[model samples]
Target: MTPIIREARAGDRSALIRLMGALNDFETEIEENRADASAAAEHFAWVEGQIEAQGGVMLVAEAQGRVAGFICYTFEEDPGAFVRPEYRRHAMIWDISVDEASRGQGIGQLLLNAAETHAKASGIGEIRLYVLEGNARAQRIYREAGYRNYERLMSKRL
Candidate 1:
């Protein structure tokens, strides 16, 4: 069944906490520099704070009366002198994660679509997100969605 995509609400607190923990664990597994997972509630609260401070939005995919996944994003405007005008204003995805149990489904895509719609409706012309080099699955998903390499971030191990 298709998941219902909607803005997260107060009633989703518990599920949000659970989902955030799952996300942390997933990242920790894939990124060598990532720290071990912490309490799930902290992740939820952190995202909530980002949303409050940055005018961000978190869209959740609800399936079977639970939050199957979520996408958190915000519109950003960089007025730096060196930044080109067209690239100054854009939407950035802070986080997008789906529960392990829901991994094979299209919930992630649904959440992404909802976020893109939200960004476009808010007048954002483009969207961007950061994915770890080890995350081939996520890279493929973004690529399939027409997201391409705009810039490269490389790391030098000390």
Candidate 2:
């Protein structure tokens, strides 16, 4: 189903938080992670702060007068001096998720496009996000959106 993409409003906070919790649960199914629903709520303030402090965008997709999904993005500082100036302050898709009932209806893609529009308006030329290696569904969606896996983050039990 097509959704209305709009900037988040005060009334959307609760629904957005609920979606974040759902996102944590969904990601946990792909790979065991340290975060859960409670952690998602706990860290949401920091996410909000990052967006506000940095000229970012928080968008929600509404259908039938309810928030079906949301996406949050912000500009990230350059990682190093060696990075190219054009992409130094790249946009980061901090979070993106659609509620269970809203899945498989193209809501995610619309949210992504909205985020890209927001980034472009802010003079950003690149956007990046991380998805678990096992999240093949999200991987496919992102790849189809032209997001490439140009980097790898490796970790080991230490």
Candidate 3:
């Protein structure tokens, strides 16, 4: 069955948390960061904070009465302190994840499409996001969706 993608509602907190746990698990596996119970709690809190941040978009995909995935995005009036003024007022997709059981079912792409649509409707001309270096699967999806590589983020553990 095709999943329905819609804006996240107040009752979607639990499902959103579950989807984030899956995302955090995959991220922890590829990065040096630790993913413990506390980290999960922190992620939940962070998601909630973003949802509460006005003027942003929070969406979820539901199938068979269960949340299959979610996407969160926010507008950045100033892309960054260093970005030129012309590049400001862009939308950023902060997080997007689908449950493990729902992988390869087009849920991720649907979430992305929804995000782009929302951004355009909101009068935001550009959208951006960061993907983990090791997440080839997600990278492929993003590229296929017409996203181009623009910058790289380097980090050093000291």
Predictions in order: lDDT: 0.84, 0.88, 0.84
Total clashing pairs for each candidate: 0, 0, 0
Q: Each model's TM-score?
A: 0.92, 0.94, 0.90
Q: What lDDT tens digits, residue by residue, belong to model 1 across residues 70-122?
A: 88987778877778897798888988889889997888888888888999898
Indicate the TM-score of model 2. 0.94
Q: Which sections of candidate 1 miss by over 4 Å?
A: none
Error of 2 at 56 (Å): 0.5
Q: Indicate the residue-level lDDT of 62 in model 1.
A: 88
Error of 1 at 110 (Å): 0.8
**Candidate 2 deviant stretches above 4 angstroms:** none
Across residues 67-158, which tens digit of lDDT does each residue of candidate 3 receive?
A: 99999988877745787777778888888989989999999999999999999998888999999999898899999999999889898899
TM-score, model 1 to reference: 0.92
The CA lDDT at 101 in model 3 is: 92
RMSD of 2: 1.3
lDDT of 2 by residue, 1-158 (tens): 47899999988988988999889888778777647787777767788999899878899999999999999988887877788877688888889989999898999999999999889888888899988888898999999999999789987766
